[model samples]
Structures are given as C-alpha cells and as structure tokens.
Target: MAICTHHPTMKQSRTNGGRKKEDTRSNAIRQSSGISNHLFEALRALRYPDRARLLWVDRFCFNQDNTEIDLMFSIYSKATSVIIWLGKENPVTKTAFEVMDSLAYIICRERNGAGMKGDNISPFAMKERPSDCSLFLNGQDFFCFSFSRKGPKMYRLPRHGSLGDDAIFRFNDDRLWTEIDGILSNSYLERAWIVEEVAAAAEVNVFRGKSNMPWSVFWAAYLGRQIFAFKPHMASDPDASYGAI
Candidate 1:
C-alpha cells in the first residue's frame, strides 16, 4: 500500500484572562482552508507520477459549507481508498493503515475463496475464524481516528454495539452482508452511516472549537502483536538490508 502524510498549518490560540475563547467564525474558515490546501499538497506528494489516476481527497473536491456536498463526500469515502493525512508520527495514521491493510487482505482473500490463519486474529476477536468474515462484520470498529498537527490518532468506534461473540455473530449474519454490500454500493442513507461510522471510528472532530490532541498517541494503543514499521529509505535502497517482522 502507498503511504501519504498530511502536514497541516495550524494557528496558535491565546487564553483571554484565564478563560479559553472559541475561535471566531472567520478564523475557523481560514483554518479549514489551510487544511484543504495541505491535503492537496499531501495528495500530490503521495501520488505515483507515472499513473495518471490517483486517489480522491474530499477537502479538494467537496465544499465544507454545503451539507449536500458533505453527504456526497461521505458516500464517496466508503467506495474510495481513503487516506487520512494527520501529519507525521500520527497514531491514527499507523492504526488506520494497519486496519485498512488487514481489511484489504481479508476482503481480497475471501473474494477469491481463501481463509486466513487463526493465530493471526486481532486481540479484539473472541474466537478464531477466517479474518474476512470478521473484517466484514467488525471492520467499522477500527475506523475511528483523530487527525491533528501532532499526528493522526485512532479510536475504537464500533457501530454494532459491543465486540462480544454474540455481537460478532449478528454482524456476520447473511442479512447483514446484503445490507452492508448495498451500503457499500450506493444509497444516500447507507452511505451516510458508512461515513458517520468511519468518522466516528476515526475520532475526527469536524466541528469548530475542540480540544487538540496528537494523532500518534491514539494509534499507539493498537500497535501490539504483529504490526511492523520500516523506513522509506530502507525499502527503496537496494543496498540496504531489509528486515522482517
């Protein structure tokens, strides 16, 4: 998978007489605009130059002020390969990539009629089965993350109540797949849920006047087990000895 990092330009705020004041509407608008520009720049850096076709980013294409446009963008996220650019060393970036990679692998294997190993099951699982079914049912739980200048952070935002065995079973019900597929395909309401679930899972605070936190801190919580990291230079350089997890 290709990796992209978002670097946002944030404005420092001041406390007024021991009381914190909310950002003015105009200031909020300016910050949003800056974030959008940063998103575009990140996309440009991450894109494969030779391949004309690349992933789509909402900040560049969607109008933040328009509800209709925002809903449309949310729908698009479910269908598209989304990369949240929450700056460097973001925990959200790490966890999101981990979840996305696992989901992608599970989905691809299942689509081709394959099964994943039991030992590889994530700690959040109750019993060992094919990862594909688990992902299809519980993938949304791993979607929430926070994005900030400090980095992207991840959270456990589950749509289907708890992560117990019974809940997992219900999520894997045949009826649910039909509904999920339909949601994945098309429909405004379903799409809204998909976006909302992902946004919630990602711990994204789209509203103005919120506390700021580092993204890396959120993702670090989920980094236990077989997760691995490597330097880009090490991967690109032929002379370098690449290590395995």
Candidate 2:
C-alpha cells in the first residue's frame, strides 16, 4: 500500500527561484534535496526496531518539481494501504484513539446496522489485527474489537490505555470528546489532497508515536458523535457519541 502524507506549510521557507525557471514555483521548496523538518521529526519518532524500514514519503519518492507533475492519482491507486500522519503526539492522542476504538468495537461486535449503515469499514478496516486481546482489570479503561465474517480482528489495546501516542488515558465522555476534538481539528485534516488520497486507498491507518488506529473507526466515531448530539458524552448515554467502552 502507498503511504499517503499531508504536507503542512506551517513555518515554511520560500523555495529557491531563479530567473531561468520563473513559471515553476517548484524550485522554491525543491531547492534543498533534504527532507522537511516536520518529516524528519516524524521519522525520528518512528520506532523501527530493525536496521531500517523503508517508507514511500512524497518528499523522497517523487521529484520536487511543481510543474507537469501527474503521478499523484496513480501512486495513491497503486498503494495497498495509506498511512495518514496527523502530527507529533500530545497528551490527547492516546485517549482519542482508545475512545474511537471502544466505539468501533461496540458497533462491529453488536452488529448495530442502524447507526453506521452498510458498513463503511470495507476500505479502512485493518487487514491484520493482532491475535491477542488483553483486557486490564484495574479502574483503567480499554477497548477490545472483533470483526465480522471476513475481516481480521481489528484492535488489541495496551494496558496503560493509551491509543497510538503517549497521550494520557481516560474513558470518561467529557474528557474523551474534549480530547477527540483536539485531534480532529489538527491542520493535517484540513488539507484538500487528503480526501483523494484516502478515497483511493483500500486501507487507511493513522499514526502518532507508538499509538495507531484504523481510519474507518476514527471517522465513524466522529460521525457517531454528530448523530447523537443531544446527550452529554458520559458512559450512561446510549448514543455512543463519545465512543465509550
């Protein structure tokens, strides 16, 4: 699968432009052959235990030239999966994933067709969910997921209750939705190209630090919240808007 990344122009420097190539703005950002600071930060945070794992980031895969570029669609379509990088992790990252996971688990396991309708899970579901489902007993909150007839078991949560990042953990609705909105409002989600990239891929995975979650589950939780907006986010509410376990 292709790794789909969104380029955020926050704190960006002007690319080098010369008199010869005036029409192309490519040289401005393309002046340097090195990767962007944000990309470098993501790469450094990535924990690939082995020697080094190869990833197809746009900065490295394609030429930096801004003119006559026509490979974006083909690249996305050819990818088996898309890795959407939200940003560096924060305290809210972990809680956001866990709550989203909890909601995904309930809907998939209970087969609640009324809420989600026709399963948007086909494109975004995980192809290989972990074999072990560990449930922690203490007051800690966690999520356990099960797939339908054809899919793999999706999420196997950690003991600390963190999602993908090292964010603080909690299962409360007020705390949960508050953290979730923080993530959803990130600059990455605002990019125009993200829609085309996500739509073209078969599976979409979102990552931050050590935590990760399926894009379908995350999206569903966001939609679920909108559907059941009348009540508060606490567990007592049956709407499942905040994605409680």
Candidate 3:
C-alpha cells in the first residue's frame, strides 16, 4: 500500500516558539501518527490478502525534517513504478472504472486488430508522441514508436485502410461520459506533487475503490472519449478512422 504525501490532513502540523518545528526522526512513529482515517481507508483498500506488496511510500521514505524537492525527482524517476491512490470507492466510482475498462479494451483491441502489438505499447514511451498515430500518415508514411529507457525500439504499424464506424457506436453512451467526469473529478488529481510523481515514473497504476488499471488504459479511454465527442466528423472520413484512439 502506498501513501500520498500531498494529502493536506497528513501534512498539517503546529509550529513552535515562533519558528518552524522539525519532525521526529523515528519514521515508523511519524508515519503511524500522521495517518488520518481517510488515508487509512485508502491503504486498507490497496492491501493484498495473501501476499505482501513492496511499496515505496513517500510518507515513510522521506525525512520530513530534511524534505528535499530534488529527492522527489530522483525517487520517482528511479522507481520501477508508481501507484496513484484515489481513496475509497463510491457508487459512481465503480461505474466509472467499468466504463473506462470497457472503453480501454475496445481502444486497444482496435489497434491490435489493425496489426499493432498491444504489449509493446507503453504510456510513458508514447506520452510526447502523437496521440493519434494515424493523423500524420500518408499512404507510404511509416507509423513508428520510439522508446528511450527500454532500449532503442520502434514499431511500424501497417496501414489498415479505415477502422470504420463500428467502434463509434460502442462509445455513444451518456453513462460513459458521466463516468469520465466522475473519474477526473477525484481529489487525487488536484495534488501539487502528482505531476512530478506521474511524469517521472516508468510505469503508473491508478487505484480507486476496488479497481486498479494501468495508466495506458486510462489514457486510451480518455482519448477514446475525445474521439467520440467529434464522432460526426470522424465518421465521415475514411482515413480518419477510430485509429484516433
């Protein structure tokens, strides 16, 4: 289970003698003392019943007395992965995850069906690249992916002509749009440190309520929603297909 350092409740402490006070050196005591009920619930939700999970919790790892912003950069960049905790689930949250899961499946499946390997896709690798891989393609143009950390790798996606309007019909749900809003409205997205935490990590996973998903899937669903919003124009063009996902 991971603990987020950005939670306001856990960060609050009283100053002493007209000066900023320092925290105690005992990491265990400090972590145990600072955990609020909300954080407790989040940690409980992330617990594994049968196995122990190795977590790089910022609250336990960072020294509050000597907290350095540079350490945040080094820690997240070097870690294997990052887990984003969005606290306990609510009624809407479950529906949101379900919708995102369904949408993500369709999005990835469409790419795979077009001859692209799903396993080769990485959100971190593709973050700065074009969201719509087909947007800049000509008939002879090669659609390629570049990776920096995971060795020098490239993927040339075959031109599958057009993906048609079949996938568009699947996303034409008001419920999906509502759920997308619900997912984005979570307070975890508002944290100041989240930007660095997400961007620097090699892999990122999101946990909300009882559901957990890869950052790639979440990003695909959001992109799918954007494509859905412009369905009218997208359905008209043969080349500008569902490849936008």
lDDT of 2 by residue, 68-165 (tens): 13556566665555666655665656766765665444344323423445544433333333336422223343354533223655455333444432
- What's the candidate order when arranged by decreasing lDDT? 3, 2, 1
By TM-score, who's the top model here? 2
Instruction: Tell me the spans in candidate 1 whose CA falls farther than 4 Å from its real position.
Output: 1-37, 88-245
Ordered list by TM-score, greatest first: 2, 3, 1
- For residues 1-245, write the lDDT of model 1, one tens digit per residue: 11112212211121122112322543465477664433433433344434333343444544545774445433432332234343222222233333323333333333233343433434333343454443344334334444534465564433343454335323334433332222112222233333443443323321001112222222231221122211011112222111100
Candidate 2 positional error at 182, Å: 2.1
lDDT of each: 0.32, 0.48, 0.49
State the lDDT at 72 in candidate 2: 64
The lowest-lDDT stretch of 10 consecutive residues in candidate 3 is 236-245
Give the TM-score of each candidate.
Answer: 0.26, 0.53, 0.49
Q: Residue 44 lDDT in model 1?
A: 39
Worst ten in a row by lDDT for model 2: 236-245
**Candidate 3 local lDDT, 108-212, one digit each (tens):** 554645454543343323323245453313333133343334543443333333542233233365444444555644445665776787778666677776766
**Candidate scoring better on lDDT of 1 and 3:** 3
